[model samples]
Target: MMLPLLEMTYKELADAFTEQYKKGPALAKALYGEFFKNLNPKAWQAEEIQASPGLADRLREDLSFSPGKIVDEIHQDGLTKFVTELADGVRIESVILPLKTHQTVCISSQVGCRMGCRFCETGKLGLARNLTVEEIIGQVYTARRRYGRSIRNVVFMGMGEPFDNFENVIQAVRVMSDQRGLNIAQRHITLSTAGRIDGIEKLAALNIPNLNLTVSLNAPNDDLRGRLMPIHNTVSMVRLQQALRAYPLKKGNWLSIVYVLIPDVNNGPEHARQLADWLQPLRAKVNLIPFNPGKNAPFRAPHETEIDSFRRQLIARQIQVQKRAPRGRDLMAACGQLGSGIRQQGLN
Candidate 1:
C-alpha cells in the first residue's frame, strides 16, 4: 500500500525521503512545504525539486493523496457547516466559525458520537467509526483550499468525543502543528473532551506545547452530570478534576470548562453555586453555552434572564465566566447540534 502523504508528519516524511530516495532533509523540507504550505501535490515537479533527482517519480510511485470531497455547504449567520464524504462513503460535518480576527474550524473526530450526551444531536447517531488522520486533516485543508477560508484555529468539538479516538486525533494534531506543514500553532488548537481520564493522562504525558484542553462539563454534581452525560457514569467529576489539575498547563494558560446551560435542567442558582465550588480549586474558565434546541431536543434553552442570573451567580463566587453566543443554530451547526442528518439523507 502506498503511504498516505497527508498522514505523515514532517519527521516521518523526511525519514521516508532519506531512506527510500537517499534524499537529504532539505528535499523533505521542500516537499513538505510544497504539499502543506503551498498545497501542491506535484512538489517534485517544481523548480525546487532540481536538488533531488527522481523524487517526483518516487513520490508518484510510493505516496497517495486522497482528500474527502465536500458534498454540501450550509451557510448561516457567519458560519458555514460543510459536509465531507470520505472514501468509505461515511460523511462528517465541520463548521467554519467566523471570529473577529481569524476563522476557527470545528472539526469532527468521528463520524457519529458514542458519548451519548442527552443534549447533543451528534450523540443521537451512534458511533460509526473514528476518522482517519487524512479525514481529520482534510477538513481543515478543504476549508482553506476549497472554500478560501483564513483558518487560524481548529477545535475538536464537532461530532465525537475526541479522547475516544485518542491516537488518531493526536496524530492529526501533530501533523497539523508541524512547522513545515499546516503550521497551526499548538496554542491555536483546542481539543474538547467529555471527561475521559485516561486520555487526559496520555495528553499530559505527551505534553504538546500550548495545546488547550476544554472539558465538556455540563452539570456540577455527580448525580446531575451522570444523568446528563453517560460518560460521567464511568469517569466521575472528581477523577476528571484530578486529571485536569495534573495536566501541565503553561504559564498564563487555563483550562476552559464548557457548561451547556440547559433550561431548568442545569441552569438553576444551586447548580451555578455547585459548579463554582467545583471549579474553585482549578485555574479554569467557564464557557456558559445556552442550549441550542435541536430536533426532538429533550431540554429547552435557558431564558435570557436565567442565563444572566447564572453568570452573575458564578461571578459572585469569583469565577471567570463567559457566556458563549450561539452560532449556526439555524443550520444545525451550533454547539451540541452537529448530527448525521445529511448522511441519513444519502447526500453522498
Candidate 2:
C-alpha cells in the first residue's frame, strides 16, 4: 500500500523519508517542507534539493500524496462550495465563506450524518460513513488552494456529525495545526456537535488548547429539543448542560450556543428567556441563527422582527448574543443546509 504523505505528521514523514533514502535529518526536513509548500503529489523537486537521479520520482510514486478529486466547484455570493469525491465515489461538500477581514472554511467530518436534526438537510441523507484523516485534511488543502488566500478559521459544521468521527477529526486537526503543514492555530479551529455528552467529555479530558466548541443547541428545554433533534432523546438537554458545565475551557473563553430560530418553533420570547436561563450557569455566547429554508423542511425562517426580539430578550438577561446572518443559502451551503447535489451555479 502507498503511504499517504499528506496525512503524515512531521516526525512520521521525516522518519519515513530518512529511512527510505538513507538520508539524514537535513534531507528529511528539506523534502518534508517541500511536500507541504504546494501539497501536490510532485511538490518535492530533486534538482532543488540535490537528491540522486530518480529519487524524487521514486518518492512521489512510492508515497501516494493525492487528496480527493474535486468533482465540482460553485461560488455563491462571497462563498465558494467545493464538492470533493473520495476514492470510493462518496461525495462531501466544503464551503469557503469570505468574511470582512478573513475567510473561513467549513469542512465535513463524515460523508453523511445520522444525528437527524429536523432543521438540517444533511441529516436527511442518513449516515454514509466517517471520512478518514486524509479525506478531512483534503478539504482544507483544496479550499486554501482554490480561495487563493489563507484560511483564517475552520468549522466542523459542513456535513456529518464530527464527534461521531472523533479520532479521525482529531488526527486531521493535529496535522492541520502542525507548523510544518497548514499551521492553523488551535484558536482558529472550532468543532460543533449535536449535544453528544460522551464526545464532550472526551474533548474536555483531552484539553486540546484553544480549540473552540459549539453545541447545536436549537431548543432551550428537553421536550422541544427532543422534537427538533432526535439525539436529545438519548442525551437530554440537562445531561448536555451538565457536560458543558464540566468541560474545561480557557479563562474568559465561552462555549458557543447555536439557536436556530424557526418561525413558529423555538422563536418565542419565552424561549429566549428559557435559553438565557439555561445558559446563565455556564459562560456562553448565543448565536441566534434563523432557520435556512430547505427542500421539504418543515420550518420557515423567522421574521426579522422576531429575530431581533429574541436577541433583545437574551441580552436583557445579561447574555452575550448575536444574530448569525445567513450565507450561501441560494447554493444550499449554509448552516444545516448541505445535501447531495451536482448541478453547478455561481453568483457574482
Candidate 1: deviation at residue 142, Å?
1.5
Q: Pick the lDDT winner.
A: 1
Off by over 4 Å in 2: 46-50, 340-348
TM per prediction: 0.96, 0.94
Taking the tens digit of each residue's C-alpha lDDT, what string does model 2 give over 284-333?
A: 99988989988666888788898898888889999999888887778888
Candidate 1 per-residue lDDT, tens place, 2-42, comes to 66878989999888877877878987888788788888766
Candidate 1 lDDT score relative to the true structure: 0.87
| Backbone atom clashes (below 3 Å) for every candidate | 0, 0
Question: What's the CA error at residue 238 for candidate 2, in Å?
Answer: 1.9
C-alpha RMSD between model 2 and the true structure: 3.0
